[model samples]
Target: MSFSFLPTTNSTTTTTTSTVRMLPTRRSESHSPASRCKSAGHSSSSLSNGFIHSIPTSAASSTQRVNHRQGSLDQLIFKLLTGKPKCLAKVLGGSGVLNTSKNSVAIQTTPIVERDVVSSLQNCSEVRYGANSKPRITNITFSTVTSATGLPTVPAEPNKARSSSYWKTEASHSQSSNNNDTHGTSVDLLRKLSVSRKESGSHVDTVVTTIDGQRYDTKELDSDPDFQEVAEWAFPIFQISRKYPKTVLSRLTYNIFQQAELFRIFKVSPLKFFNFFHSLEKGYWEIPYHNRIHAADVLHGCYYLSVHPVRPQFGVAKSPDSLLPAPQTPAASIMSQMSTLELMALFTAAAMHDYDHPGRTNAFLVQVEDKKAILYNDRSVLENHHAAESWKLLCRTENHFIENLDPAEMKRFRYLVLEYILATDLKQHFEIIMTFNDRIPDMDLQVESDRLLVGKLLIKMADINSPTKPYGLHRQWTDRICEEFYEQGDDERKRGLTITPYMDRGDAQVAKLQDSFIAHVVSPLAQAMNESGLLPILPGLENSELWINMNHNHRKWKEEIESTYEPTTTCNGGSVNGVIEEESASTSDSPDPRRDSPSLDSELSQ
Candidate 1:
C-alpha cells in the first residue's frame, strides 16, 4: 500500500512533524512504522526500522529533534536491514526514481533526511571496547519505514523503548522454547525452583541429576565435603548474580554445587575443580569452573584439613606433644589456637577468588594484542579481572549474602576474601612455595596463626593440584581444560588471531602442549605438594599409580608429537623411588608377592 506524503500546513506544527498514515497489510500481522513510532513514544527526529513502528502520537514531534548518537543510529539501520530487508531495497529503488521525479524538492529533502537518519542509525551500532558492553537497545527509524511503505518520503523517529522490550521478549520466548525442548517436563519446575531459590533461602525446589546421573541439589549436602566447599565458595553468590543480570550465575552456581557433591567423595581438591571455556567476546567465560567451583573445591579441601585425621605414619603430629611451639605455650595449645573463623576465611577465599575468570592466562593477556592485556600491562589478566568483576557483582543491593554486618566488618570481610582469592593466581606460585618452603619446620618461618597458615597452604595447594586426582576424575578435568583451550583457540582463529603459547590446540601443538604440561605444570607440582605433606588425605597414594600413568601418557604424547622429547624433569625425592625395587622384583626368579603393586606414575601415564 503506497501513499502520498503532504507537508504540514500549521505554522505551530511546522516545528513538529505531521504523522503519516500507514495502511494495514494482509501479508502478516506486523507492527507498521507509524504504529511503532507512536507506541515507542519516539521523538520526531528519530528514525524507524520499518514502515510500521510502535510510537506514541505525542512523540511525533520528538522525532524532529535530531541530536545524533553514534551507535544508536547504526543499530537502528542494522535492525531495519535485517528486519525489513525487502522494504529497504524498495526504498533505495524509490530513491533512484525520486532523483528524476517532478517533485525534486521533496526528493532533495528526502536525501538530507535519509542521510541524517542513516548517520544517526550508524551511531547506534558501535562495537564496545570490552567487558562493559551492555545489551544494545534497538531503534526503528523513518528511511526504513519509507522504504517499506512505497509512500512519498516522510520523516519518522525510531522507537527506542518499545523496540527494545519487543526484542527482549522475543529473546526470552525463544530461550524458553529452547529450554522446553531440551529439558522436557522438568523445564517449568526447574524455572520455578530457580526463581524461587534466588528469592528464598537454601531450600531447593527440586533435586535432580543430569543425563549422566550426576546429582544436583538446591541445597548443600552435609556429608559431602565438596558440597560444604561449594557452600563456602558460594561466597557472595547472591552479589555475583545481582551484578551480572544477563548471566546465568545462579544456574552455574548450582552446577558447581552439584559437581562438588558428586566428586567430593574423592576428598582431593583437584577433582572438585574444572576449567571454564571462553567466548569470542573478551572478558567472558563459558561456565562450569569459574571461581565458584574452584573455590568450592578449595573450601572442601579446607574442610578436610579441619576434620580428617593426619596420617601418623607420615610423621604428622596429631597432638601438641610432637608438632612444635609458637611462643609461651605447649604444642597442643598452639594447635588449638587455630580458630575455625580463620580457617573459614581461607576456604571462602579459595572459593570466591577466581570467580568469573576470563579463562585466558595472564601471560597470554599481556603478550597478546588485546586491550585488556594492555590495560593490565600483561599481568594476571584473568585474575585481575576476576577479582574486579567478582567484587563488582558482590556490591549489588539484592545480592547481600553476608548479612548482618556493619560497614567496617563488611570491609574487613571483603578484604580478606579478596586477598585470599587474588593470591590463587598462578603468578603467585613462586611466592607461595617460597614462603611455605621457608617455614617447613626447617627455616625461620614463623607460624603465628596455625589456621591462617594452613588455610593459605591448602588454598595454594588446591590451585596447582589437579593431576594428583584419581585418574578418571583427573582425566576428566584435563579434558575440560583442553576444551577451554580449544574454544579460545577457535576464537583466535575466527578473528584471524595469532596463536598464543599454551593456548593453541591445533594438531601440531596439541600433543606437544599436553606432554609439556605434564612435565612442567602437573607432575612437578604434584610431587612437591605430596612431598610437602599438604595432601595426606589422598589414600593409597603409594599404591595409586597416577604418576606412572602420567609418565606413560607423557611418552604417548611425545610419540604423538612427531618428536623425541625427553620425559619431564623431576625434583629430588619426587620421582617413584620404588621404581627400581618394583622392576627388580618383577624380573626375579621368585617373584615377590608385592610385584603387582601399582606404581603411582604407571596409573596416570597409562
Candidate 2:
C-alpha cells in the first residue's frame, strides 16, 4: 500500500486530500512464488479489486501546498491518521517539522503508529491484485480502516467486508489493550524529543503528547547525563547521600521530582525547580542538625511512606493482645486517592518544614525574646517562621516553581504547605497524635477529607522518623541533635541564662534523655501508628532494634555513672583494707567529690 497527498482547488478555496492506493505484490526475486504467496496471504490476492475513495479535506489557505513524499508504510499510516504535527514529529524522530511554510500543516508520525500500523494495516487485505487493474466500486470507508489502529485487524477479501458493528466491537477491545502501551510510548517519545531538542540547541517550546493524544507545551527535560542516575536513587536518602556526598542533594531532588513525574504534571520549568530547591537549601541554617540534611531525610521518609504499602510495614498482627485488628488498607492505596496537588504539597512541606531553624527550642526563643519569637507572638515560633520564610522564598522571581498554578490552586497549595509545616512543631505533637488516634481506628480513606488528614499525619511522622531508622543512623542523628542542643545550652549559659535539661552539657545524661524520648514520645507514637492501623508493623518499627540499641547505650551510661561513684582512695596503706580506711577518713573530712564534680559532662561530651 502507498499513500500520497493531493492538492485540489475550487474557485472559492483549495484543499488537500490524502489518497491511499493498494497495489499488487509481485514475488520478490529472493523468494519463491510459493513462499511469497504464503507470506502475503489472501490479502495480496484481494488487493486486485480494492477501490480508492476520495475524502475531502478542510480548506487550506491559498499558500498551502501538498508535499508528496515516499516513506515507510508506518510513517504514511501515522501521517494519514494523526492530525497533530507534534505527534508526527515525535514518531518521525525529529526535533520538529522539516522545512515548512506558514500555511503548511506538518504531518508527523509517533511511536504509537509503529506497532499499530504493522499489526493492523499490513494485513488489511486478503487477495492480490494485478499491477495494472481498473479501480472497482466498494462501499468501504477509511474511517473503519483507520479505526483499526485502535482495533483488532480484520482480514478482508475482494468480495467480503465486515459490518460496522464488528468493527466497533474490535475497536473497543483494541483501545483497552493499547491504552497503557500508548501512554508509556508517549512519555518515552516526549523524553527523547526533549533530549533531541536540547542537543540541537533549539530553544523552541516543547510539545508533549499525552496518552489520549492531547498535546501541551512543556520545558525540555533536563539532559544532564546524571539525570537518569539521580532518578533511580529511590530512598534511604541519608545512605545515598553518604554514598554520593557531592551530588546527593541534586540527586535527591531530581529523583523525587522525576519519580512523582511532577515536571510533566505541573508543567514546571526545570531551571526554576532547581533554583527553588537551591534557594531552599541555602535557607537552612548550618547548625549541627535541623538543617538541609534533616529536611532531605524527612522528604525521603515522606516519599517512601507515600508510595509503599504501609500495612505490611506497620500493621499489627493477629495476636491475642493486639489492640487493633490487622490493617486492611495499604499505604499505597491511601496515596493513590490523593491528588497530585496534595502529594506536591506534602513533599514541599517535608522539605521546608524546618527552614532557617536556629537550633533552639521554642521555649528558648520565647524566653530570650528573640525577634522571630515576637514576630509570631511566641506561638510555634520556629514552625511559623519556617512556613513563612519557605513560602517567601518560593514566591521570589527566580524561585517561583509553582508560578504556573492558578490563583486558587496556589492558595490551596500554600495553605496545605503551611498547615503541614506547622503541624511539625513539638508543642503540637501530642495534639496531632491524639487526633490521629481518635480518627485512625475507623477512618475511611475513601473520604477526601480523611485522606487529607492522613497526609498531614504522614508529614508529621516523617518529621520525627529519625528514631525509626536503623541503629547506626539513629545514633548518628542522636549525636548531631545532642550537639545542636549542647550548642544552644552553651549559648544560654554564656548569656547567664539557665540551660534546658537535655541541652545542658554539664548535667545532661544523653543516653537517659534519649531513652526517655523514645519511651515517652517516639515509641508511643509509633505504637499508636501501628495499632491504630495508620501504619503497618514493619521490622523497622517493631523489631526492637531501636529500643535494644537505646537500652544498650543506656546501660553503658549507667556503667559510667557507677564508675564515677567509685571511691577516690589513696595508697595510704599497702593493704586494700587500709586504703579503704584512709579513703573513708578523707571523705569524712572533705566535701564529697562526687557532689562537687559532675561526671555526665565528660562522659557525654565524649
Candidate 3:
C-alpha cells in the first residue's frame, strides 16, 4: 500500500510504477473493483480525503505472443457481447449506472483506470513495423482494457479456424440473454422501435423533431439554407438540431476543415477523420451539457472567432436564406495571422477539450476520490485527463490526423493541442486571466509566447461562451449546465460531502448562479480578450454585442431572482426557458417528479 514507484526496468522484465494515493469514499463498499487494492487498511492516505487508486503492481508481467490474424478483434468481441451489450457501454462511453433493479444484474464493468499494461514484447516492438503493408501488424503498446478482469494480458491468439461448437455456444448465450432482457431492452443500451406507421426498407435509428414547424432531418437540414449559415456563427442553433448531435458535429467540423483547407494542407484523410470523429462521438457521455452537442457548439465558437474567413454580425439569422456569413475579409481577424497547422490544432482541441466529460467538476472528482483525481495527484485532474485522452485517441491509426505531418510538425501540433486543452481548466482561470492581463495590453502576435497565450484565450472563450450568447441560447445552456451541477449536488448530498456553491438542487437557482458566474468569471475573460485586439474574438463578444448579451442575461437573472417562480422538478426543462425552483417540502407532499438521469463515469480509467 505504501510502495515506492519503481522506474521502468531496463532488463527483460519491465517494471513501470506510478505514485497513486488511496481514496476516501462515503460508501461502505468503497472497496469496489477499480479502487480496490490488496488491502484497505494498508496506508494512512486511505483514511484521508484522497482518491482511491488500485496501486497497479509494478511487478505484473506478460509473456504472451502477438496475434494479428484478421477478424481476431471480431472473435473476442463476439465472446464479450455474447451476453447483453454491457461491455459496449463500458468501452464505448460510460461506466456509471443510474438505474438498477433487483431483477437486473448489478453490472460489473471493465474499469480502464490504470495505464501500466504489462507487455509481452521483450524488445522495441512497439513501433509500427508495417505502416504501408498488409497483415498490417504494428506493435503499439497500450493499456489493457481486458486484464482488469484478472485475465492474462494478451492479444487474441492467432485467429485460427474455429469449429461450429464455438458459434453454437455464442448463439445460445445471446439467445438466453435476450430472453432475460428487461422488457426486451439491453441492460446498458435501451432500444426503441418505430411506433409510427411510416413504411421503411431498413430500420433507421433517427429521431426527427420539428421546431417552429420547421422539420429537421438529413434532407430538410441540407435544404434549409440556414442550417449551414448558423454553423458559421459563434452562437450556433443546437436546439434546432439537437437530436442529431453526432451528425451535426461531423458535418460542421467537415465544413470547417474545408473552409480552412485543413484536410488538404495537413494531408488528413477524410475516411480517417470520419473514423476518429465517430469514435470521439461515441466516447461522449449523454450528459446534460458536456455531450456531443456541446462539442459542436464549441467547435462553432472556436472556428467563428479563431479561424472563420468572415465574422458575421452579432445577430441571429431569422432564416438560412437571410443569414450569410459576413463577406468581411479576415484582415481584422486573428484567422489571417494563424498558420494552417495551428488552426487544425485549435479546431481539434475545441472538439476534444471536454472529451468524455463525466458531468462532474474536478473538485467533485477529488472530493469523491475518483481514481482519475488520485491518478493525477489532485492537480488539474480533469484537464490532464482531457489532454492525455485526446492525444491517445488521436494517435489511433484511424484517428491519426497528423500522420502526414513530418515528425517535428506532428510534435508541434500535439503540443498546441495539449496546451489549448489544459488551459480550459477552471482552476487555472485566474492564472490565465492574470497572464493575459499582463500580455493583452501590448501583446505581439509576432512572438511565439504571445501567440500561444492567444490560443489559450480563444479556447477558454469557447469553453465558457454560453453566458455571452443570446438570451434564448444562453438560457438553454444555463438550464442544462445547472441540471448537471444539480446532479453533482445530489451525489454530494447523498455521500454526505459538502456541496459546492451554486450546485445544490434544493438551494441553487439559475438566476442567482448565472448572475454570479457571469459577473465574476465570464466578464473578466471577455474584457481581457477584447483588449488583446482579437477579432471581436468571441461573437457574444464584439461590436458591443458581447457586453450587451452578457448584461442582458445578468439583468434577466436578477429580475427573476427578485420575483417568485413556480416550483418545478429537476431535469424537466422546467418552464422551458428558466430553471424551476425546487418546491418547498412544506408544499403538498406529492411524490418527487425528479427521475434518475444518466451520468456515466467517463474515466473509470476522467
Model-by-model lDDT, in order?
A: 0.37, 0.51, 0.51
Better of 2 and 3 by TM-score: 2
Best by TM-score: 2
Model 2 gets an lDDT of: 0.51
- Once fitted onto the true fold, the runs of candidate 1 whose alpha carbons sit more than 4 angstroms away are 1-284, 287-307, 311-338, 368-371, 374-377, 405-411, 442-453, 494-497, 538-606
Ranking by TM-score: 2, 3, 1
In model 2, what lDDT does residue 602 have? 38
- The backbone clash count of each candidate, in order, is 82, 25, 8
Any runs in candidate 3 off by more than 4 Å, and if so which?
A: 1-227, 230-236, 308-331, 535-542, 564-606
Poorest 10 consecutive residues by lDDT, candidate 3: 113-122
Over 1-606, each residue of candidate 2 has an lDDT whose tens digit, in order, gives 222233333345454443223332221111122211211212211213342323334322356423334233233333434532222222232222221222222222212212333344434443224344433222111123333123322233232222112112111111223233423444354346534533211123354332223233333234534334331212355665566543345346656766666654454655556667766876778788888888887887677666554552232334787777655744343345465666788888888888888887777788899999899998888889999988888887766778656444566577778878988776666666778667654566544455666787778677767656654567778788888888988998999997766577776556555544544455555555655555533343442232333333434444554565444522221121111111111111211123211343233235
> Residue 320 CA error for candidate 1 (Å)?
23
Find the 10 residues in a row with the least total lDDT in model 1: 579-588
